[model samples]
Target: MNLPLNRRLFMVGAAAIAVSGPAFANTTHIVEMLNRHPDNKKLRNVFSPSVLKVQPGDTITFMPTDKGHNSVSIDGMMPKGASGWKGKNSKEVSVTLDLPGIYGYKCQPHYGLGMVGVIIVEGEGMGGNLDAAKDVKQRGKAKAAFVDHWDQIKAQGLLTPPAEQ
Candidate 1:
């Protein structure tokens, strides 16, 4: 038996909606970090775009163009029991963040030089107030330290000095 035109159209519409729904639902943002400094040998950290704000379910792509650079979350600074990742030799790693909070992370060997960064995860009904999250103090301090020594860091050739510090 042949189906009616209306029924066939409804099925087509349903299939189209099902196929396109996931595409629109999952959106990922790519954040790239480069080891673009001579003195980066001292600290393997994210020099450019050090701070990132992303929504839940978004992905941050950490690309290290140079060797001896990795991205990892730290305990107390990130979600509980977080740890750093091993260096990726010219590879891209994608991190999908789902929690809504302030996440602090650093390179294992370079945590001393403040090779640290923050991920402000914005949640629903939060009104983009990522600073309201817990552990803001520690994350803020780390961010400030990184910013404070940015000049010296660039001078040391660990990062490409932007037009303005």
Candidate 2:
């Protein structure tokens, strides 16, 4: 009650801002499109951190650390109605996914070579489309790559089959 008018107004404004701020800040993840795995030279045309986990409203930026590489989402690999992205080769692309689900992506040119990655968005309803994403047909080396990704995801306890859910 003893506070000056301007000081009281300032305190009220600051309290309003604090109360309206976002509850949690979204994070940005980086994925590098590489010609060779940083840890293993024998592996070719890979996405470093091939399996990424993110939160809703988070951003994933794919950087072309090596040439002839681009990131693209597979046709049936995302939550229904979620927008997919395609990056130009040799350029960087950033996408923010607000929907919670599994996203499977690969390099357009090297898809058959198994240049693929998975993004798992964690939140309520995150597993709604997991089964559909897992059932997407993969060809060439991509088949094995996706199998490995699925296994890793399961190991992490992130992927739950519909029957179990």
Candidate 3:
């Protein structure tokens, strides 16, 4: 059957949306950081499943397998700040990403070693062109603003040290 061009386009669009529905669910994705490194510091890596793409309202759980390892959001997508810690020995850190933008994150202590990751919140025409590491650098300045407030955070006890190594 020869369908009209508009109808065909509609069908294709609908199919694409259906196939990518799971990526937009308001759920959480857990990413762990293994505490394995020659220096006993957290390895400079995003741990398992490096690439994580989730929809708005979804949460990403960062769990440190070793002590002294933590994940900090270098992008403004997280409400807290550019840097937040999930102590090496602490439980999982759950972040509900409710905005529609690309978010970059990394482990502060290990950032110099290139340990980084990204989260792209599904929204109008923002998909299909995401570079995890690049996003972190682009948002570097905004992240710095948040990092400046670290002292206040520490006083609040929001910063938890990793477990005893």
Best by TM-score: 2
Better of 1 and 3 by TM-score: 1
Please provide TM-scores, in order, for all candidate models, with all chains considered together.
0.56, 0.84, 0.50
TM-score of decoy 3: 0.50
The lDDT values for all models are 0.55, 0.91, 0.55
lDDT of 2 by residue, 144-164 (tens): 999999899989887553353
**C-alpha lDDT (0 to 100) for residue 133 of candidate 3:** 29
Q: Which stretches of candidate 3 lie over 4 Å from their true place?
A: 1-25, 36-44, 75-91, 125-165
Off by over 4 Å in 2: 1-22, 160-165
Question: Model 1, residue 91: displacement in angstroms?
Answer: 5.2
Local accuracy of candidate 1 as per-residue lDDT tens digits, 1-165? 489999999999998998888645656665555554444554345545566667667777776655565666655554432233443545667777776555655665455656666665555432232223233444434556545544443354332222443
Ranking according to lDDT, highest score first: 2, 1, 3
Best by lDDT: 2
Candidate 2 vs candidate 3: the lDDT winner is: 2
Q: How many clashes (backbone N, Cα, C below 3 Å) per candidate?
A: 0, 0, 0
Q: How would you encode candidate 3's per-residue C-alpha lDDT over 32-56 as one tens digit per residue?
A: 7765533445444434444465666
